[model samples]
Target: MRAVIFRLMGVIVLMLVGAGLVGWWFGPLPAALVACAVALVVIGVDTAAQLRVLAWLKWPRHDNIPTARGVWAEMLYRAARQLRLWETRVAHEEDKLKRFIEALQASPNGVILMDASDQIDWCNDTAAAHFGLDPKRDLRQHAVHLIRNPEFFAYMGAKRFDEPLLMRRNGSYGPLLLSVQIIPYGEGEKLLLSRDVTQVERTEAMRRDFVANVSHEIKTPLTVIAGFVESLRALEFSIEERDHILGLMQEQSDRMRHLVDDLLTLAHLEGDPHQPAEERMDMRQMVERLAADARALSAGRHRIKASADAGGLRGARTELTSAFSNLVSNAVRYTPPGGEVRITWRVLHPDYGDPYAEFSVSDTGIGIAPEHIPRLTERFYRVDRGRSRESGGTGLGLAIVKHALLRHQSELRISSQPGLGSTFSVRFPLARLDLAKPGQAAGAPDAPRADRESISA
Candidate 1:
């Protein structure tokens, strides 16, 4: 405004000077007209220059005050750029997190994520399946509400993040052994991991049962041996009586020894599941030796027979011998006084296009129930505890067979009907079986001898 006023004043001053000069040089009318035209031109030119300056001033400078709309537009652009960068970063991070969560969902173990407020923030498919939860709907719910176990609830309520909680979850699927762990994450967040340990728990239970069964088995044998020892010590007897007592003690001691040996064999087999297969043993000779041992162990109480086609197996000789011996011994032990035990070996073709050495020990003894067949390989599981004791069984024979079969990558199958006797077969994979040397015969010379007198027929 000040500059505009100064320009106007200068224009007026110039007009007065021009009018005076014109009047001095010419007549008054002509001078006046000339002065007015000159002043008007000068004023118009000044006004136009001032208007240009004002237009330049109105255009924004680098550091000049900006219009409200301009400032708002710039702010909005920066905000949008920042938001785009943030959104991109979030999407990238979310994609990575989604892959990690998908992997967790596919894992066999159950997993759950909880927030700082002890609420279930997220859970994988396995965890949802184990808990029988609706994955889409149950998010953000309290974990305690879903898993209603008292122990787990107490553990979560106590804020004890250090120790994991062990509990059982009963769901529509079945009972599941659950191990729950809670960990503190960033800021106020928490992470929870759950694992189903049902199989492990079952194995532990079986171990406990085995220990108890062994204790009971050993106690009974020791009691019998102790009673006989006491009886011998209490009375003065003839040479025949003394010999009889010593023989009985020897039998008890032998039974104990056999039991201990079997237990040790089972332990050894379990320790090394992947033993080297350097030795190729002849199945025919092995069966022969086993039959001889079985016959001798039976003591003329039962007839024994051996039959085999042609097949040798590659495995630890000592382990294979122990396994075959256990099978034959089990058969002989279970067979009645006049029953017959048969050992057979043949090459079998399975549906999986694999050749296997099928070795079977069939006995005319009291058969096993169908329900009990599955658990027969478990340590110390017995169909007839009293009969097993009377027959001097340690109850670990089949257990040893199981471990041995596992080492050989073989399968043990037991089929029996009550009173019809049983057949226990161990099928060895072809990879583990080797043919005997060309010169060697398929059958052993020391095959079991069947005595007609001991035959039930």
Candidate 2:
């Protein structure tokens, strides 16, 4: 500013000097006219420069900045430089905002921003899905109006945000459980966070049901045993009568023991995170043992037969036996007298997929319904409580089978129709199959035979 003032003063001085020299040569009137002309020209030039600067400011561009001869040029240069700096800062901030929004959109939890008037300001995709809202259409809409839930409106109206609110909504697939919390921030605005708790809620319900089931299972046998003991202690009875009472007590005792053993097996399977050791097991011996157990369980009333292909399985022997035995025993117990239970172990060499070994137990028995098949692996899940008890089943057979097979990288597939029959098959991966010739194809005709035995009544 001081430099501009000085330059202006210098111009005035030069004009006056020229005017004085002109007045000395021509008259004072001509000299005054010359001074006025010089001043007007300077004003016109300054005005033009100001107009150019104003035009550039209206639509400023880096390359098209107005050219100026003096202070105007410096001013324009500084203005452009400042604008560039501001543009860079704005771009950087915009990028950060974009990333922050993207992170919120990708988050499993839902996030919503509401203005002071309780109107929707912004919401991520997750939040929109949670509330069945459209991000674009819902902007500036009243939150309570859109949600249309009395509980949520009450929560917001109460002005209390200490605890989260749980709400159930109808989802596309099924019912959805949401845990929502509101946080007040930034001049009366609110941030709402929502999380889907459907799975958590389901697990909690299952836990409660399991506890109830366990208590009931334990109590029923205890009641029977206690009643029998009281009768034995307080009543006078004949020898046969006493024997019958004793036998009843013993049956109840055995039922409780079996239940306890099954509970322990399930607990062990769930607690042990490590996979079963890959020990080579003789499939023939395993099959025969399973057949023997099934026949004994059937008490010679049902036919039990088993056959094995020429290959050994590599897995924990005890776990495999337990899993296979459970399937066989279930078949025997569920089948009526004179029914047939066939157990087969074979290798498969598919045309496209990896070779795998399969162990299948098929039973001609009262089969499971379609609805009950999905929950068959749940612990203590019984299709018929009275029938399961009468058959001496602890109801943990399929659950144990599921866990043990999972540890061996195997899967159990069940196909059953009510009153027709059920087939339970365990498919073992190639890694767990110890074929006689490891490289030999499973379908080769020349594959060496191990031992094959089939026993039926």
Q: Best lDDT goes to which candidate?
A: 2
Query: Per-residue alpha-carbon lDDT of model 1 for 5-105, expressed as tens digits?
Result: 77568768887788888888887987789778987787576566555445534653334332322223344345556656877899999999999988987
> What's the TM-score of every candidate structure?
0.69, 0.87
Q: What is the Å distance of residue 163 in model 2 from its true position? A: 3.2
Candidate 1: C-alpha RMSD to true structure equals 10.9
How displaced is residue 33 in candidate 1, in Å? 26
Clashes of 1: 0
lDDT of 1: 0.77
Query: Candidate 2: global Cα-lDDT?
Result: 0.88
Give the distance in Å from residue 446's predicted Cα in candidate 1 to where it truly belongs.
26
lDDT of 1 at 84: 67
RMSD of 2: 3.5
